[model samples]
Each structure stands twice: as structure tokens, then as C-alpha cells.
Target: ELSMSGGALRTFSRCVTCLARIGSDLVFQAYPDKLELHTLNSSRSAFASVSLTRDFFDHFHLPADAYADAAPSSTPLQCSVLLKSVLAVLRTPTSAIDRLNASLPNPQASKLEFVIHCVSGRKKTHRISCSAESDVQTLALDRNGFPSRLAIRPRDLTRLLSNFQSSLQELTVIATEPAARLPGVDDGTGGKAVELLSYIDPTKDDYDSRLHTQLWIDPAEEFLEYEHAGDPVDVTFGVKELKGIFNIL
Candidate 1:
């Protein structure tokens, strides 16, 4: 059983929604001191994972009998649950809950129960059935190995995204060592690292046509740093999905 404030529940629900975007079925792993949720996209191109510590909740309990055997330390309790089912119960108004207690009956339990304690002394209980079995791919990103890094504030990226049409798909991020250009929007200065966000559109009339929107970010001013020793580091991502992922983060 896990008991926590309403705010923590809401935050956790939001995290679940983020992984739900990748897929419906999710694998939740409960360790002695932490909980992990993870999912992967259909194409296996995107993955999301969240790790929660005991400190995240007001009270956390794992009954010794809940484990399949006495040696639970060697095997954490793992369960499969549908994201939609869990979200349906957790999407309640935050104000309606004073606190909540969630419990997994046992390692083989078929459902998880959440007891909502309302401020008015009214109690509500909700249960989301567990799935028979499922699998989730583990995503391991080596951020330290990423040669180029862009540190633009969230608001700035959101504002920039607002300018592009919804049909705009791919966003390419490039780190440049500055190039010669007019002293207008893209005045590039040498020795200064410049980051560029390019909205790719194959429908444009000409390849060189300036119909695409390009936003130049001054890396020095933004404190964006790179550790790569060679050419510019470039990476591309789907703007639509990335926006949702970043917003959740």
C-alpha cells in the first residue's frame, strides 16, 4: 500500500499519461524503495520511463507476504496494467481528494485498488484490473555521451513552436560554429556556437526556398555547450510528439 497527498497523485497521473502516449500497456516495477513505470512506442523509436522514490509518497508499504517468495530482494514485484484504466480513476479533480491509498494485493493480484480519502470525510474506492502479461522495452540514454546540447528554456521552445503550422513534422537541431551571413536574423559570428532549429518541409516549391522557418539560438548567450571535436552535431525529432513529451517533462 502507498499513501500520498492528492498533489503527488496528480503528478503521477500526468507521468502515466506521458508514457501512455507511447503505448497503452505498461509495466510497473516495485522495488524495496522505488517504483518504475515504462513504455515504448509502436515503431520502437521512442521510449519513456519514470522512477519514483519512497520520498515521493507520505507513506509506502510493501507487505512481506505480497511477494511470491521470501526472497523478494532478488526479484522485485512486477505488474502489467493498462494506462487508460489507471488514468480514468486518477483523473479526478485534485480538490476532491485529501489523500489516497493505493495497494497491490499480491505479486499475482489481478487488480490494483486506490482508496480516495476526500476532504468531506467521504471515501471512494476505485480498482483498475491488471493485465494478464506484457512486455516493455528498456530505454537507456547516455546523456553524457551526447556531444551537442541545447539548453533553451521551455517557454522559448513553446513560443517558437507556435509559429510553425501543425502540418510541420520534422524538427532538426544543428550546432554550428558560425558562418558568414548578413547582419539580419541570421548574423553568424565565428568562435560563437549557434544553434538552429529547422522546420523541414518537403512540399516546398524549391529546395533552397526560404519557406521553411529557421530559428537561430545564440548558444553562448544561452550557455549551450558542446563537447564534440568535429563537425556540427545534428539530431532530428518529430516536432508534434516531441512537443507533447517536452511539455510533460
Candidate 2:
């Protein structure tokens, strides 16, 4: 309480309504000796997907919006519209990929593009994060909250999306290997100017932290060549499992 520690260790939780949307209750807590996160969920299981993601951004305060609405027994932050997009971008990944290892000229960045019909079955939401590129790239987030497995790998994307119209979808990421603080290691941004986004914590701030990695993609021209050059045999987007991941948060 503010009166208990002179505001040094004050915490509280409550339920709230936003934009006419009746949301679940929220939780809040603060401690002087350490940083604490407050999360409020109607059900204990409701927050499983958001817990790790909240901590990921809290370290950087990317949205830094009110952590949550006051919930009767939940921890919640009233996040900004921009911050709300964070969760949709962090969900499970599906690889609709059909090909990889094609050749093309190397530019300042790499590009990847694909599309899922999301047809004939259960529609699920997907969240994604990708590398920055010469042109800003965008990952898709399903409007609904439910997420299916990421169906495409950066490589298979070439084959899977090959059937779709070229103008329908695309992704580009700058493959910059930034400069390393160490004597001979590269930083991985490829010596390009890095944008100063405060929400993105640098490697030095938390040395042991694992950074978000982007998929390596080649130019669009090479993949596009498959379009006009062949039959619809190269691309295949199907119900398949993608390996090499721990778990989707």
C-alpha cells in the first residue's frame, strides 16, 4: 500500500471495461526488491499464451501501456493499440513453404512471400515476427485468437506460395549481421545503419538472453521465376508439422 511503504511497494488489481468490450479481470503487483508483473485471467489457463510474451516486452516497455485493466483477481495491463499487436505477432508459426535454395542477386535485404487459403477447415489466428529489410516486411496475424501451427519454413515458403498470385503476398527482412562488441565477432546487421527502437533491447543489456531470429530468404525474383516457368507441381501447402521449435507461446 502507498501508506505502508511510502509508495515504494504499492500494488493492486481490478476488473475493467475498454472500448465497450467487457474483458476479464486483471492482476497487479509491485515490489521494491524486484520487478513484478501483474496478470489477471478469468481462468488460470487463460493466460498461458500471454505470460512469456508479457515478460518479453516488459523488459523493453515496447508498448508500456497500462499493464492491464483492474481485474477482480487478474493481472492485466491496458495496452496501446500498437502493443496489442504484439501478442498476435508472437503466436505459433506455420510453414506453408514449398521450396528453398533458389538463386538470385543479393540485395541490402532478403524477401519471402507466401499465402494460406485458410480455407475448408477451422480458421485460426497466427502471429509472426520477421527481419527488417530494404522494404518494411510484415508477418500475418489472424484476427481470431486461436492459432494453428506455423505451416511454412522460410525455405518451403518458396514452393508452397508459388501457386498464389505474386501480388497477393510477400515478406522482406534485412539480413544485417550487427557489429560485435567482442574483437572479431560480427553484430549481424551487415554493417547497415540500425534503427533506434527503444523497445528492442541490445545484446549487451542482457548478455544471456536469446534474441528473436529471422528466417533467411532469397530474392523474390528467383521464386517468381517458378511461377511463369512451370506447372503447379513445385508448391504444396498442406497439414504438416514444422520441426526445430521448442513451444509456441
lDDT of each: 0.72, 0.24
TM-score of decoy 2? 0.18
lDDT of 2 at 69: 38
The alpha-carbon lDDT assigned to residue 166 of candidate 2 equals 38
lDDT of 2 by residue, 1-249 (tens): 111111111110111111002113222222222222223222221221122222222122212233333432333222112212322322222232111111111121132111222224433433222232201011123535422112234455545334433332222222222222245556563333212111223445663453333333322322332112111111211111111111110
Over 4 Å off in model 2, which ranges? 1-75, 81-150, 169-249
lDDT of 1 by residue, 1-249 (tens): 788886787788778778777777788877788878877666766667889998898998777766656576656677778888877877777778899888888877889898988888999899888886665633457888766555667776677677666676777777754443334664355345554455655676764765567666555565434344447777777775677666876
Candidate 1 Cα RMSD after full superposition onto the native fold (Å): 4.9
- Those runs of model 1 whose alpha carbons end farther than 4 Å from true positions after fitting are 63-76, 132-152, 175-194, 199-210, 223-231
lDDT of 1 at 110: 87
Candidate 1 accuracy as lDDT: 0.72
Lowest summed lDDT across 10 adjacent residues in model 1 is found at 178-187
